[model samples]
Target: MVLRPHGGEKVRLMVVGRKRLPDAERHERHWGFVEAIADSAKDLEKGLRAQSYGTRTRGERTQPAARPAGEGVYAVTLEDGQMHLSFALELPAKPGEVQKAFRIAPEASYALSIKNPEKGKPVNAGLREEDEADYPRRLQEEFRGRRFAREDVRLLDFEGAEFILIGARSNPEAEYGLDLDTHDEDYQHAEVIRRLRMVKSRHPIKPLFEGRWA
Candidate 1:
């Protein structure tokens, strides 16, 4: 994980992950960036989880949400004074669907950091030239219709929330896994692809993309 100051109030965080395989040549690597507001760390975590996982469950059954497998990294961004986190995953070209195999990881870890961007350097956000030019306009529009900036609002801060991290059982007798095939693969694939493309197309420009202040 790498963090560099984005614009005045945001940070650009890049997360890189690698999958180890018996064959060195077969190893896989994945990476993505999160542009998050430079606010509370708790907000950053919440934003990352939401952007990465989406709504917890879908359909009437309300199943346990799928989880990410392999190593993963994430960051946060602030849009219109509210922090937001975003990232992309490479899935089969199918739309709206993410493979179960893609979600479950045997082992993974993440690191978070914050720093100022390099001087006179530009970051590629994987946007087309035209899309890049229009990014500022889109950002302006996002906040234009809003009645209040998020910073102007105040909410009670609460403490004493309990958090836990649990590891899976190593013994086969104690380990359990679910194997359920209830949804149409084609539909799910299409849906996942559609949503991913939508996010990609938006291509909002981050302060980091434009370079940091001197």
Candidate 2:
């Protein structure tokens, strides 16, 4: 994935797949790897926090940890007074059911916890509004002149962070449900939106950039 900082410089984030380990081992190793990266980054720059995203299946279910996982992972750090992060994920065949998980930026999560220890509700109302407002433009840009449909898009408070879930299906005539074929443009669009939303929601204070950009 390509991430552009506030200054317009782009950085590419890549996920290295763990092919030898079983699901359980990979899950454990992934978080450890993330922590190591965050720690190393912090040595150079203090106050870096770990963040992540990933996909989970029913059989793959595991007890929740202090940090959560998704089909991907990220490390959020401070850069020139702005929060910066990178994305990485394993893109496997579309699971029978896609469960996107997110561990919000640590500092923000902690602040929310202190403010409402009982509820820890994410202050994402404004983010949701911005997403809805930008959906049409994002869809048009992603679809271009092609035909497609928004399969599913939702925002939920999960594990203390706001989870933005999005899916799309292309060639509307080909199937009545989400076209899981990863190579399909529609499926690609959905992935882009998923990642875009995650990054858009990352902020030290409030969420930034309301719209999706490839």
- TM-score versus the correct structure, for each prediction: 0.20, 0.18
Candidate 2: lDDT of 20? 16
lDDT of each: 0.25, 0.24
Q: Write the per-residue lDDT of candidate 2 for residues 65-120, one digit (tens) a residue.
A: 21112233333333333222223333322221122122211111000000112222
Q: Hey, what RMSD does candidate 2 come out at? A: 19.3
Runs off by more than 4 Å, candidate 1: 1-25, 45-100, 108-214
Best by TM-score: 1
User: What's the C-alpha lDDT at position 110 in model 1?
Assistant: 20
Weakest ten-residue segment in model 1 by summed lDDT: 153-162
- What is candidate 1's lDDT per residue for 1-214, written digit by digit as tens? 2132222323222232332111112223233223333343323433333233335465244333212221112223333444322222222222122222233222222211111111111365332333221223433343345432222111101111111112222221222222211233332343322232323223221211121224
**For candidate 2, what is the lDDT?**
0.24
> lDDT score of model 1?
0.25
Displacement of residue 122 (Cα, Å) in model 1 is: 14
